[model samples]
Target: MSRHLNAGERIIESETLSGGITAEMRKLTIWTTDGFSRNLVLRTYTDSASLQHAEDSLERESTALTTLSGSAVPVPELLAFDSTATHCEYPSILMTHVPGSTVLADEGVDDRVPLLARQLVEIHAVKAEPRPREYQAMTTADTVVVPTRADAEVWAAAIDVLRGPVPTYDGRVLHRDFLPGNVLFDVSQNAAPSITGVVDWAGASWGPTDLDVAHCSTNLALLHGPQWGPRFASAYEEAGGVLSESTRTRQYWRVRDALACSEEVQSWAAPWREAGRVDLTPGVVEDRLDAYISMLMNASGQ
Candidate 1:
């Protein structure tokens, strides 16, 4: 609705809907020189208070892209960036569309499960700068050092332990969100495609190699169920991955994910509450919530 937008660039057609973080992701039918031929997905964020932080994330992504430039990885090409404004009123980025049939079968992630593990191993195989840690406001180092002993808080606790020992460990390149959905399987490459692009650089950070694997493995199980769980780990081990070293780190993320799910229940709360959007049973939420809690308990050696 802002008048100061780029000239003659009225949105041909657009739709607003929930995106990855409860924010609106808009699909724009734009007027291109060749005609309205492009379908672009634009995700926006609010909280002007964190504009600077958003820009930093944008910059961090830029660095990751640059690091991944000459590799086999597939990622959306960064098109436009304006990290300084609020959603619909601030900075944004335009990316090339990544189109392909999802590898996820109706039953869930298929047995070609090892593909994910292979990619993770391959990503770490990439040589790049040390990964930066995400501390919400005051980011930390990637080298993890568990000091005197581990704490009970899980993810944050691991960071505390690692901070005392080695805040930043020079490790393999980590795709912070290297999940199956984040992965694009190439059907065009005669079995495996020549390129597999990983999207969503929001949480891309450098750290332990196994952290990436465990994040994907545990999350897949959490999202899809136990069937795909062991296969993921199986594929990971087959791909030269080490489970022992990062299991603790992986546990941290598993617990962190549960906390994330809990927060979402509160998101869109006021509107949903007024709209009677609490259709999902409370027990269902608790069941899913408990999965993460169980994972945390197991990781704590409790």
Candidate 2:
């Protein structure tokens, strides 16, 4: 911390920031020689499993921040990183604090959806040279967790979709985890709401744009409603973002990502519950996922 600080600057305060499940996030307030304070975000992988299993996560985030600097995407500026924990107690990356807060409330979602869609379009437009690692699937058909009350036939069909070969796609820069939680919004009273920044770049990758869309759509379904899942896909298209040409191919990706969240809906709801969305219990999320899967199947003419 001292090495990155400007001369005569000292840390004035530190506070934990929420919405991070895999890492510890801290906002460091620094008092500079000019008698003003600035903020920086420190993300630390304190969990032993993260350090042991995903050893290159911090390195990937650092590289991503470096790559996206000055691009249209609003991402934090990387200040420093210690991927091996040689200089810090845990593997950490320090970055300039991006302004705004995550908007998880159910109210005003209709207004915010299009902005989220547009910003994601801008993110995919970026051409990453020496791109980040290729995207990896988080769940397989065998690994999918079927909800107890889910329609057994529908769930079976969804799982079978994943068992088929992956569809062909043109690679694009992907914000591999571009869900609402990772997006920050500026919603001032007098002005329209807009996306201020997108954080959590550790999962950034080079992949099909549909994969990124699927991830966010699945999250929207769980966080808001089943209608919102398909609504977001429509919003994305209206925002000038193109999806896979075939409806079946799009359904395959959407079903795959939706099923991936089945096992972790309860864990995912914990943070949102803490953030004041107590209505989003695990059961509610599961029901939404089931509805979302059924919608995709029907849309694909199953």
Candidate 3:
């Protein structure tokens, strides 16, 4: 595999990374004949009809990485991608390994929030052509099976507000899954950590800047408590991240995002648990969703 990646080189070490649900990721260390070495990440997706969403995500991620090379956005450089899974076990993408860790350290939220806010602003600032598919939040309407009354009521109210035409935003690049997990930072003993890379671009697409902002806000509220949601928005606005002043505009995105919280909570729980967050559970997620919905309602003056 190392020779395939770089001529005359061999893999010295390989380690699988943790906390990925959609794809399998591994870090490969390869040394050249003269002993020079480099690290790269190999990501592969299994072939499953049920996992089409994950496969599509990898495709978009590959496209985004290739598209954003040499751009200001801090993304991993794409080395190679194979859709046929000929080289590896499954369809794979090889990229330069980024040097940093996620913001899971017991660091002060105050210290980290501003850096997170500003970097997100930079991501939305990047330019991209609009993709044919528009971003859609997972509403209860998307479900085919019968839903409980409680779930029906929750989604019914959301559907009422979201029934109108899908609001549009200036076509900006969106990291659809923007959150603490996807953000990597380089931390030193003496200084503050700075963002090194924004990863997991499988969810990348074209949308309004605020859509990403709202998604991050939901994640902040869910993971940290509702208080952090407003703080994140304030920091973003203070750092000049574009957000609509109109409460209506903001809630349009927020409500759509908040309604999807249940699924996000379920999807993210396994990874969070693997990362040592045993406190995460479906009920906790529900409570967080309730708080977030209240926050959005208040923000929109509804």
List ranges where model 3 is wrong by over 4 Å. 2-4, 47-50, 129-136, 140-156
lDDT of each residue in 1-302, candidate 2, tens digit only: 99999999999999999878889999999998988999999999887667773457877788889999999999999999998889988889999999999999998999989999999999999978898888889899889898999999989988999999999999888889999999999989988898889999998888888899899998998888888888898899899998988888888889889999987878888999999999988788888888998988878822
Give the Cα RMSD of candidate 1: 7.6
lDDT of each: 0.54, 0.89, 0.73
Give lDDT for model 1. Answer: 0.54
**Each model's TM-score, in the order given?**
0.64, 0.97, 0.87
Expressed as tens digits, the lDDT of each residue in 203-257 for candidate 1 is: 6676665456656754565455534444576687788875544444455444443
Clash count, one per candidate: 10, 0, 0
lDDT of 3: 0.73
The deviation in Å at residue 204 for candidate 3 is 1.2
Please give the distance, in angstroms, between residue 245's alpha carbon in candidate 2 and its true position after superposition: 0.5
- State which candidate, 1 or 3, has the greater lDDT: 3
Best by lDDT: 2
TM-score of 3: 0.87
- Preferred candidate (lDDT higher): 1 or 2: 2
Index of the highest-TM-score prediction: 2
**What is the descending lDDT order?**
2, 3, 1
